[model samples]
Target chain A: MSDTLRPNSSDDNQGAQPLYVPIKRRSFFMYAGATAGATALLLTGCKDDDDSSIDAKTTVDVGVGDVGVLNYAYALEQLEAAFYAEVLKGGYFTGLAPAAAERQIFADIALHEQIHADFFKTALAGNAIKALTPNFSAINFGDRTSVLTSARAFEDLGVAAYNGAGRFITDPKFLVVAGKIVSVEARHAAIIRDLITPNSFVANDVIDFSTTSATARQERSKLPAEVLAVANTFLAESSKVSAKSLV
Target chain B: MKLLSLLDRLSTADAPAAAAPRRDLLHRLGQAGARAAVAALPLAAALPAQAAPTDTTLDAILLLLKLEDMLVALYTQALASPALAGAAQAAVRPDFERMLRHQQGHAQFYRTTLLTAGLTPPAAPRFDFSGRRNNAGNPELFPNVLNDYNAFLQLAQQLEDASASIYLNQVAAFATDRQLRDVVLRTQLVEARHASHVRTLRRTATASVAVKSWPSNADVVPSPAVVVPSPAGASTPPVSIYSFEANEVQLVSATTAVPFLAVLTGATAVQFVALSEAFDEPLPTAQANALLNIFG
Candidate 1:
């Protein structure tokens, strides 16, 4: 997966040719919007045959607009997929989840995350960010306590991230798509939390008890900046997904 | 947060023909005969919630309030039940207690929001956990839901699952007000998590319970053998709360069902279960309201 990131050789090639390049994330959306169909055609066309060349961009920017948000999700899914894949490869926390059924659950979750990652990739054909390299140095794959705790953190973060980003979504269809995926993420979060501690699924820490009304059960949300602050600890700087303008 | 975004991808990836099939649901909403059993009050005497729900945003908020009300009632009854509270298993008590508190919190949020909006929050309806609507004359649709732990869990799972789908169905309605949309969407995931934990608890207790953390076509709950009427003697077909839940097919467009078998690469036929598990199907407002009537 890490091999998917390669330096852009096209930059050197484009230096010889006078090409129109987007200097700001906002400009990318403007250009894409002005020639919506053509922009889609270019993105799809570029990925179909010259995916390697396109993937070689040193830093893949999840551009602005709904497309940027989709790319942002695609980037996160890539990291999650890699993390679970590594977990399974490392024997699924050994004695912690030695049972065949427990391993199967992890495998199924891995597939779900991979499908999520792949869905975003296909949806954002050319605009999808490069596959992220996960730094799992902080995680102890062999220890059940360590692995499950990290899984809980990642799942809860994924849930909060989607909730915070929903307002920025413009297209109704896109909002529907996000709703579908986030529920599944919430499900994953619950199960992982339960595995860590039977009914610790909706603890006060993850949900806000202090709403305008004291009794409202508002699930806590993290802005992109806050989510990335934690998510970036595991993501290499080169592949960091910037949600600076997501709102 | 991320859950809402995942729903976006799930709609695009799973529901290929989402916008069209829902027309059938819209048609059914007109036919869902029974009105919410709130007392008739003149506008001058009280601000009735239903008087001017012409605005979708207002309508969504009201519906959400009712939904949260139903949950709070269900959990309140369950926690009060001697069967559950007196069980040998002490761990389950706090779970329901915490759950009840959360529902109360959600109900308070909606109720206060409605009051602040200058509309009177609808009076809370009486709930019968047995699905008999507290009428001694009616046969029980759900037997011993509050008394039987397993039965309580089954109902809990269904309500939570339906809660998640119902919120997803209303997301578009709250588009006009982003703050309300955020609250609804955020609360929506909390419900899904609640559903997951309940399902997990059920799974731990019963070897026969075949459910995952998320909804799936494989986890089919057999339809009850009997159909019962509400207190007002409104006899209806067995509720379809769990019927549409096991659906594997999702629409991508008005007319297109994304061929999951064809498009998803390297996945075997069995992985299709994972596909359905990966995305939850939304429940229409009429069907949701119909199901919510079961507890009233």
Candidate 2:
């Protein structure tokens, strides 16, 4: 493992080069073998922190390389899944008509996020990060406006995170996998935005719209460090995640 | 040596003009020297062995440009059509305009990248929205596509979904250029947003079209409602734009699956649909080009 993993640090410099040390093939296989099948590896890897001194306050650093990218996605998916799960449990969602479009949307999105979180956890296996507890106290889930606004932010953040992290992924297959999931997140972002304000699916805030240059119409992407800064605000101090090595 | 040769072929075959302007454009794009900048990257060094005959970065950019050009035409024509004069259609006109602008921006981005790399992008083809392939004699696979609002929305949904999938399929071709790959990924998400918006419009426009914001097995697949004429000796059969999108199994490698069964237990029918909708599948290049050919 790399020694760059740190706790509760703020490193948001995009100009800084990544401090990445690729995991050796031999060591990867060794870890895989020692953990029996790869499925148990992720569970054990996440479970190891249970008895360790690392508590909720310890900032979990998403390590470097492809593993770092996977963990980064895993962390975001976990946050999203937890948020939607909380929303489903809250008064607003429960208060909606059982057959309401908003109710179905929330239920479907909750399942999608859970599946995404589970997929990453399975794919990362030994490289998976421990589940982080979300801090959504700022979001009043009892109110429709507050819940939808926070949902938009999380979905948009998830899309930008995946878009920005693609450059850090070395494996072509991992890039493909990230490509698969980011689009769904973008879909989620569009619908959530539309639900808040109709026909506002592709807004100027989330997408660059420059009159001088047509090529700048790409979606605004956020580096891992920048994303984590906002994400940490919605996460508990102990469950806050960092990607220092990723930068 | 291989990188140099590929660059040489690109410059000679595509751009016979003076190299000074190309170098200037590259410098302005933060790539000081196209040849030197590309050669210095690790991905560029490995491209010779990894790239297939048709898998060049240039090919990926050109394909994306074509896709975007088609979308730009689709939106421009639809917005100008008299069929969209209704209150419902007028309300969503701005959404189509926004989508058009993004497609134009994306197309411009690819065109500039090719020029910066000392290549000439192919000219935009004349698009026929009726699916008659710019010929009156051809069968219309999508009748009233531009005349009927519901039909227009259906075609729009399919095109957006197909474009997103095509972008997903071509990510590897841009591996040699990280900046290009990043743009492609961002644009791919934008395409997904367009797809989701269109699906929303379709769902709201009618109760018969059951679709979600994201691709789902439970959603009704949009069809042209006409038999597509296949090219002679074509190996692959004509497939819907949404074909194979319902696949539940996701492969991380050739041998290793994602093991969704083991991970997501208690296989309820709804959960199974969620599993498919969780990950968007990539459309193969041949299938994508075939769809594009119908509207050419």
Candidate 3:
């Protein structure tokens, strides 16, 4: 533990005097995206060094039938909650110009995602998915713009994730419930994107004009694995998780 | 004229009040309700109404069509008001216009039925968004809307939520008419989406805004065991028409005007920035007429 062996503060320093700051920041964000994309490869099977001790081969069952859908929701909530928890951990990207506004928003989303996670946990009870860890080394938690843009991506994806998965729930009641929550997710997505750029939230890309149903104005969805990959980047190693397929 | 004096009498009430519209809404809905169940009532001849109640099936369709027309008219007028300004003004205009078009489409669809039934459809009026169809010289309809973005948005939200609730009830109560039922459901979903969009717009205009959309997880149907007895059906029923967005907007508005929002299942319900987050019930045609009377 000599001073020479100690990690140098300057090595991690970014933003100023760092010719490589922008490149590193860009690469870091893409890292989260990359991790998400490579999750199937990473998660093909568990590694022995699992620190959180959250195992898929273990006894935590997400539920049977509709419970699977709830468990799926619980899984996503865990990822969202973990992301927000980490964002607010250091009080939201220090030294950013919109730090205060962004932190408040971060705090709100953190609370919401956490609440959503808890709602499914309670609703599913024993059938709920176990907590998952998130990996954030790809995110420059220290960089505000990257974090917010990353946030916009996550929020948009969360809304889409919930919406695309709506029809999968077999129970009529559960489907309606999914509708209610998905709309809210849409609202959160819209707000976050609006903050990033005004009027960018509810675009035709997000709403389906071809839909015949009055309430069917939501965006088309991507695969669950795809959405999870985007979410995985935000998950740190400590937040590993898994849930039964609700769909 | 009495309605005018009634409104004048309440001149001392709060500047931005929704109570007047709420009461008028009841009368309007009462007419629609009566008209909807007209066929069921053997005493249709005894009751005086602008339009006679035909049969329950057509009654509901006609009422729904009327509601859609009114919604279109109200939205058009609100957006047209000289009082609205800036982005708040711009944001609502397109939505209002789209809604007007939708309402017209609904009207046309129902008009086909009315025509086949040997009845003439009601004529739609020119919209006065300024809320000034009253007081020939008073240009104060939708007063302080544009410059006062909150007022404008609150009104916008009020209309959207009202439309959402009405659509919800229509979807549940009128499951008998297959074609109409399908149309109602389709339009109802759009109404909810429209409501969601308006809510987001309202929140965005105000800096203190939070989630405008409801969670994607709340149940639309009340479970069979928990299902409240609805007038729509005669026997005890199971939860079939569940709406997931119930978490965002409650069904309590079904029982009365000024629908109250429920707390989210979580200890902390979702947050929204507004003068008041509760639903501002729609004034049915009768009720809207009542408000219009107040100005006369």
Q: How does each model score on lDDT?
A: 0.67, 0.74, 0.46
- Count of backbone collisions within predicted model 1: 38
Q: What are the per-residue Cα lDDT tens digits for candidate 3 across B1-296?
A: 33323333444332343555433322232233533553333222221221232334444555566656666665555555553435536755665565555555666666665554434565665444445664459665455543465565555554555455444433323333333444454454455555656656655554434434432222121111112222233474422111212223322112221121232334234554210121211222332233323222
Q: Judged by DockQ cut-offs, is candidate 1 incorrect, acceptable, medium or high?
A: acceptable
lDDT of 1 by residue, B1-296 (tens): 33233323443444233454333222222221212211111221122211222224445666787888888888888787854786454768888888888888788877776554334677888978677778988888788777877777888888888899888777766554566678888888888999988888877874337677777666756335212222222564544555445556544333444455654554322386776677765665566667777776
Q: Clash pairs of candidate 2?
A: A56-A238, A57-A238
In model 3, which regions exceed 4 Å deviation?
A1-64, A91-101, A209-217, A222-226, A232-247, B1-150, B161-296
* Evaluation by DockQ, superior candidate among 1 and 3: 1
Give the poorly placed runs of model 2, Cα more than 4 Å off: A1-57, A213-215, B1-7, B10-53, B206-208, B225-236, B265-270
| TM-score of the first chain of model 2 | 0.77
lDDT, candidate 1, at B186:
89
Task: Report the poorest 10 consecutive residues by lDDT, candidate 2 chain B.
Answer: B44-53
Q: What order do candidates take by TM-score, descending?
A: 2, 1, 3
Error of 2 at B10 (Å): 5.7
Model 1 lDDT on a 0 to 1 scale:
0.67
| Candidate 2: residue A148 Cα off by (Å) | 0.2
Model 2 C-alpha lDDT per residue in residues B82-133, reported as the tens digit of each score: 5465676778788888898889888888777776665567788999988778
The positional error of residue B123 in candidate 1, measured at the CA in angstroms, is: 1.0
What's the residue-level lDDT of B255 in candidate 3? 28
What does the lDDT read for residue B72 in candidate 3?
63
Interface RMSD of 3: 8.4
